[model samples]
Target: MTTLRPERYSATAIALHWAIALLLLFQIGLGWALEDLPKGAAQFAGYQFHKSVGITILLLSLVRLAVRLFRPRPEPVKDGRAQMLLASAVHGLLYAVMIGGPITGWIIVSTAKVRLQTMLFGKIPWPDLPVGQGFHEPAEVLHGALGTIGIILIGLHVAGALYHHFKREDVIGRMLPGAMKSHGVIGIAALVAIALGIGALICGRLLSFAPANLVTPPIPLPSASSEGDIAAPMESTAPEEPTAVVSESAVSSATATPWKLEKGGRLAFTAEYNGEAIKGSFSRWDATIVFDPEDLPGSSISVTIDLASVESGDSQRDDMLRSDSFFAVGTHPTAQFVSSSIRAAGEGRYVAKGTLLLHGQRKPLTVRFSLNIDGSRATASGNATLQRLAFGVGEAEWSATDQLRDAVGVDFNLKAVKKAR
Candidate 1:
């Protein structure tokens, strides 16, 4: 009697099998890492990488399935019909999950409502599906459930191969390369990989369940100022040192003179949360302006905002806003704006080109306003658009633009008294 050799899988099939297996292992670990990261640029980058790998897995799985369908496979070892049927079911489920997991994740991204671009591995661009919001939660649930099912099916598949190989059968040899002889070694490695993957998933879930506010102390806001009261002027009149310079326009019809902020002035901002607009104001801020409607070239203005003096009506929200996630009051307690140039927009209307420094980031800003001077009393009303993210005003989970619009509308109704010559 002559001993028979087992038929091995085609070279292409074997290559794809191992390639996808390694990628799947990497993806499982990446997903676990993504969930445990804090909600910031790092976490965002992690998501992008995870999405890229998931999509790669999806494409590879499709290719493998196509090859499996058109190409011939090695014959099954001599085994009972019941065992063969069980093996077929397990393999079928594995294939289904390999394809379905990425699709479900894609669906979640498609319906997320957040305007996040999918940059595959930070290089290739990937488009979201046509699905809209409302499917995100459901798709997330299904994807997670399928992940659990995939783990189980993988265990069964590995166990079946080991059972046959240990029983002196040719089951594992069918998929192994011709040079490989020991199926037991490969089976044990696969088992270890699966164990490590499960452990990572468990640890990730525990971290996700931990409270976000536990590590950091609550941020404190400055005490509110007395209502309807104006801050008394300092007895000294020496000019305070300026942070930045403003270019003086050529003297024109407008006069250039100093003006001081008086009682009844307000600087407020509006931000949107969950699609609802919320308004807030700073009770303590100072403005220094040297302006003349005719002398546009010799005009300048600078404003300093006390971040801790912010009042948004709701104390809880205000505290959160001052936390490390938003203003980080302890690190940056003030926001400043200095005009670089002032140009007349229209009749009594003007635009101030300037730089705004907030949360340690400085960016160019423009304020459009109308000015009316009535002798010593002057009134100026203006509005400007501020991008919160540009200045790192919101970090972590608050970084999501969908939850809070990046653009905040800042409006000021300033009352000023001109300094006597």
Candidate 2:
């Protein structure tokens, strides 16, 4: 019992409406598809897309609602009052729910306090909103709940449409596009939707990569106590000549305190992948240390660790990680970190910038460590986050869309005591 004319909708209107709807459905599918992915780069990218698309859907839905509102459409007088009210309510709820869902997601992502960037393949960056970190947990809860509810709402809408088409069949023809009546029109629109969908997927993949587009190369931020709070760059402004001097005063008395590795030292380390935390320990570590507080500036250091003694207690992970694929223990066993510059980060902490020769890839990195001295021993322990690809490890498992990042949370907790000379 349809009274309205069966004329076609404006091409622009129809195109926009279908495009938005299809995208929303695709987003839901993506969310579910990636729900259990391991948490490093791939998951980070997924969540980034989820949040960005959520925001996009919310905005587009609002615009569509407004169009439906200010731009009046002819009413179907033949449809029952129940049908009209139901449709109105459903659309109204969809608009409201879609808008709220992404806002909650954005707040949650902001609050996670994870300074993670989203890069798939293309170069899209997710803009972070100003966040008050204390509310992270609350925001996360709302984000999860609202998204679930919104999905349910969307599912109901689709289910109802199918019910009308298959079960009720009272007015399936009304909701169907006018193009459905013409074989030619139907084929063309179908072709168009498919083409557009494919083109968008390609664009979506192409638009998510973020490079190290840093405005400023990350330097050691100044401490409150540093004179004039100057950020000393790692590289000296003055070029080094081959004739750098080794003074008699520098050679004979470079280090006031004796330097040698301490016994019974412990170093604990932890790694984070995709949100899960994994820990490891190195009980036997040798370090040469100097503790003349006045000669702290001239102090140099080296650490030699036993590759044979690494045990995070999980043999499977330990063995697999130690294999040729990861560390390649049989050929090149031990991992060494040698430090050159030991600058005070203040607050009893120090940033050691040096080369971490891991898996034979010597990458320059800054390892920040804390110090404590008791009678004969001092220890420095902290963690650094770096991309795994930088060191040329784990090559087989990399993809732009589903990549596992090498920038894991590599941490340390070292305990060292001086050995009797």
Candidate 3:
């Protein structure tokens, strides 16, 4: 009589099985963490990461299903018809939840009112499905329902595996690698840990918690004088205009006279969060211009912006913006721009090619503006688009371009008075 060999699953099938299992666990934990986070950069990042991992799971599950359809699987263990039917039903349900959960999440993202993109691992751009915003709430409800179903199905799957292993059946061993031995105690213990983790997550004990109140102390005012009287204000002096002789020369060599930013100047940027536009400004920034519209090559400009001075009207969101995951003000407190070249674009329009150093990264930037000079006073209005990711402004979880866009638009309206030579 010839000896018969026991069948085992292919390496690909086994690999996919374990990969999906681990990823699903991670996804579940991430989902819990995401829900626990308060609405800010941390929560925003958690949501993106959760979506990324869910998408990964979705892709892997599809591949696993495809592989199962095309490749051979281990023969079913010898068991009663009822037992076989139970096993098949359990597996079918597992696959359904695994695939359905991510699809529901995708639908939610696609239909969300806020236009958000999905980035795979914070690098590859993943587009949302072509779905209308009307479905967002419905899809969100479905996603939550699927998640609950997934937890139950996972529990049943683990119980079934334990039942087979404790009964000394060959089913569990068929999925294990040839080099590894299967023990009922070890498998049951692992399942118990997973069960406890799931229970803790459901009970809101892990990672999820309400945010504490954040207090921002008021800035201290200058102390009163020893006599208990406030200091007198300095006498104001009006800016002196260039003399007629100097003005005549400046008309020829405009680069010889420097320009001072006037009181009405404004610098602002627009950022998108959750499909809404957020407008902010750097309250403290200075610009030095040595320019002559007549001398393009000789003119130069330098701008220094205090990152900590950012104000977006919302205190919580402002604090989050200053956190390490976004601007990282503690490490890099200022951003700068220095002009390398200036060229006339049209009659009154000009383009300044420069290098912007932001968040410790330097990149070439161009600002286009139309300048109007009325003798001694000048005005410049311009806008530029900046890619936040290029400068590492949004770090780690904030790196997702879908939730927080990579492109930020900067606009400035500067009124400057020309200084005498």
Candidate 4:
């Protein structure tokens, strides 16, 4: 059998050691820097990236520890009883802290009260932490403290390795990786890792779909007689003329009262995107709106958007929207409005908020519309923005250099004329 040398690490071990070293340093720096950002989209993005990287490192560390335990490592020529024991203790603690820190952090994140994206490569995965009480807050504090402990351990580990390599001038410095030194490969590898990281981030957005369970809009009327005690609507944009349409849920036994399409109803809609101007309102939709105010809580608003009937008079723009980018009529077939909640805003206006469920994702939207009461017909209109990229509605690529805005402003006018028995 071939004889073993004093204390030089093998190529694989050295590479792994260095990789973990760099990763730990990066994690500490990024985490500290990210904590300084205000709680918003910037902080949200940073937290997501930090959590992802931490989980990755923790998994890698576990695997590395297992490898170390099974395989034999080079014994240092000058290794003493005290030095060896110290190294073993330090490494064991390091592994424990790394694993525990991230798990605690994840627990903290899962319990966050804000709407932040908690996804894995764009898949809206459930949080791994327990959902209730005292455990979570304490876990957050522990997560923060343990992160520092990990950093200190890494610093100690690195310093000790270097001391052995330089001060002792031992076999520790002669690691196989140190022997075959190359600048190009390291640079290329770094570039590739960064590129893939960015790509994964971008592509993740497309894959993730987290639906908001909103208070759904007024259920359509099966018949006036089918009304149960109408649940107090969360909000309502329907007029207060003693008629509210019965909620005709597809799954429920209630059959919606058939409404005749009315022409000349006014339309309104709005759009808002991060870092872009709040663009809104182009009312060309004139259609009939009808619903009984007394039956309001049970009635769901339905809109039949006449694409060809659109008279913004901008043929080229309308055609582009109707084609693939905006409406994508060929597959989606038709565009419709569904309300989620109908809470009163003020005066005659109520905030009708809900999911657009566009492209495929249920996009959260809110429209402030007026409820005009005139006989059997009720007119309602409002505005909301659609962030295109957030929902994978378009490529967002304009030209070679110019990038289009992530949001598209949509305006719609809706009139509901009360249908007969």
Instruction: Give the candidate number with the greatest TM-score.
Output: 3
Colliding pairs, model 2? 39-274, 40-274, 122-206, 122-207, 122-208, 122-209, 123-209, 376-418, 377-417, 388-406
lDDT per prediction? 0.67, 0.52, 0.65, 0.49
lDDT of 1 at 49: 63
| TM-score for each candidate, following the candidate numbering | 0.49, 0.42, 0.52, 0.44
In the range 206-300, model 2's lDDT, one tens digit per residue, is 44323222011212211111011111222322332121123346635654354343444455555555556667765444554544444555554
Write model 1 residue lDDT over 131-195, tens digit each, in one string.
Answer: 86777898899887876687678779878977886787766666667766666665665566567
User: lDDT of model 2 at residue 196?
Assistant: 63
Off by more than 4 A, model 3: 1-6, 78-83, 181-421
lDDT score for residue 173 of model 3: 61
Comparing 2 with 3 on lDDT, the higher-scoring candidate is 3
For residue 230, model 4's alpha carbon misses the true position, in angstroms, by: 29
Which 10 consecutive positions of candidate 1 have the poorest summed lDDT? 222-231
Sorted by lDDT (best first), the order is 1, 3, 2, 4
Best by lDDT: 1
CA deviation > 4 Å runs, candidate 2: 1-8, 76-78, 117-126, 130-138, 162-178, 182-421
Candidate 4 TM-score, true structure as reference: 0.44
